[model samples]
Target: MKKTKVKVKRLKKGSNIAVISPSNGLASVFPHIYEMGLKNLSEVFGFNMVEYPTSRMLSKDLYTNPKLRAEDIQRAFQDESIDGIICTIGGYESVRILEYLDMDIIMNHPKFIMGFSDATTFLSYFNKWGLVTFYGPSVMAGLAQMKNMDQSYEKHLKDMLLKNNKSYVYKPYKQYTNGYKDWSDPELVGQCEAFYDNENGFEFYLDDEPSEGELWGGCIEVLEFIKGTKYWPEPDFWYNKVLFFETSEEKPSPMAVGYMLRNYGIQGILNSIKGLLIARPKDYTEEEKEDLKKIVMDIMTLEFNVKDIPVVFNMDFGHTDPKLILPLGCVVRIKPKENCIELVESPYTNKNK
Candidate 1:
């Protein structure tokens, strides 16, 4: 696959961000939360956010409707004033919209795009096209936290997207949350799930040294769904990449994770990539995390016959609250000895450069 031109530029204060619903539009389901997110993007983050044609159109029908979602994305990029794009939130079926995407349009008018979970479908796609797409935060998912923001998340995101900082070292969340109260209840607005301390930091496995590469991969569930589709890339495409993986709220079992890793090994992808970075699974017990680690390691080493692949787990990103943004295709150094992930290059280029 030939790489497309990368036109991603750093976002500045007051950059117009098109809020599009490439997947589920929770904004339609919970209008108050959506409005709150819009307010924060404007007032707190100093961004000019614009809603596209179907940003608030919620339903399985529209989500499955590829042309509508694709048009929103195309329009967002075609609009000269829009500097970035954000998904309203993730859902079960973002892959459905891939066929309708005008890749020529996306390639010709590249811009920053942000979202994760099912949004991974687009994140990985754009990365393969050589455009930087973020794999963290969404309107309904990350913004609108009541009364407080995760200081680390806010700073890192601002530094990269708003300030154009090139260097960063990731630190584990001092506290993290996987708890979710029902969003259907109006009283739960701006409410946070219970949080517990994450004192141990990243769990380094295999070779706990350092590996540098552009980041790849996204939500495992979405990756599985898109496999063998036109959107899926070859093993050679993953060469010299630091692949990241996270489970969605669905939280498949440990055995299922083994199968996914095994499939990668079968495709000869495991040995080709430089490293692996796994997120703390949503709502998993400590025991389950350990189990997952063992399963993946066993398959990669014993079953797949690959060794010293450089793996890390329990990083602070994905479905969890207070998650960090990872711009796919950005250069990052995964240093297990330092217990951190470091950005080596700004994820953006100058507009005129």
Candidate 2:
């Protein structure tokens, strides 16, 4: 039997959001970007930003004490006043904090929790426990750079986080940037690097027919860290799910990404999933993107003999600027004829009641 999903309350203008550094303590290292993100959450989103204990702790201290990081997450969930929780930034070793987390406290007091990249560890785990989690944006990454990106991004964030729309269609941004300019430069704070035209919003390699499934997945690299651990989902979890994945700024080569996807084929995940959504990689060239897609198709069709599933590439999420938030456990539909993706259900339990 499927577990009933624990829905969170809708966040409004005055809602209080707890900010934590569950991953790398980049907030302490780069206070400018972090502070700018908090400011945008306040001025733009109208959120009351509350900083947790680990939000600005030193990187060395945070790395040495995973328990402390987990405690901050627990305390935030325990706090009734906090309407939601967001990460300060993403780090590589946040998986270490998972063992120390109190699942009971988290599941019982389910509220809004959003992050990406390294956040995949807890977000994916929580969804497995039947709690909806968000895989989009962190403070220093997406949020801080918001003011400098397209207005569509700000609208997208507000729509996903604030509005309780029964159905929402994701529209690709008019433009995109690979990454931020420089966090350390006072003048360059909150500015992205170069901008590129989003000529092809969402390219579909396979769209035999429209399909719908619960949304799940995160940074592809981050998912690898928990593959064999207790936090990894069971073999049956992939069934009837739309798995979304994206690469980070590290820019794993096309061949490297192919190896990762090949593992999914081996695990029978490619056959089990309803559809596959690949976000535009952080800093890949046009040729590299084509190579990645070809490798993915080869793995699914030639290697695994699975070709019916809908495959979408270059989605506007993950490391790209002007992100569209994807809520895990929410049902989303892909309409081949319409060439569009739609969130078929409201992620929140309240539904703006």
Query: What local distance difference test score does each model get?
Result: 0.81, 0.91
The alpha-carbon lDDT assigned to residue 24 of candidate 1 equals 81
Please report, as a residue range, the 10-residue window in candidate 2 with the lowest summed lDDT: 344-353
Point out where model 2 deviates above 4 Å.
351-353
- Determine which window of 10 residues in candidate 1 has minimal summed lDDT: 144-153
- Give the alpha carbon lDDT tens digit for every residue of 246-302 in model 1: 998998888898888788988888888888888999988878988999998898788
Q: What TM-score does candidate 2 get on C-alpha atoms?
A: 0.98
- How far does residue 309 in candidate 1 sit from its true spot (Å)? 2.9
Q: Clashing pairs in model 1?
A: none
Candidate 1, residue 289: lDDT: 86
As for candidate 2, its clashing pairs are none
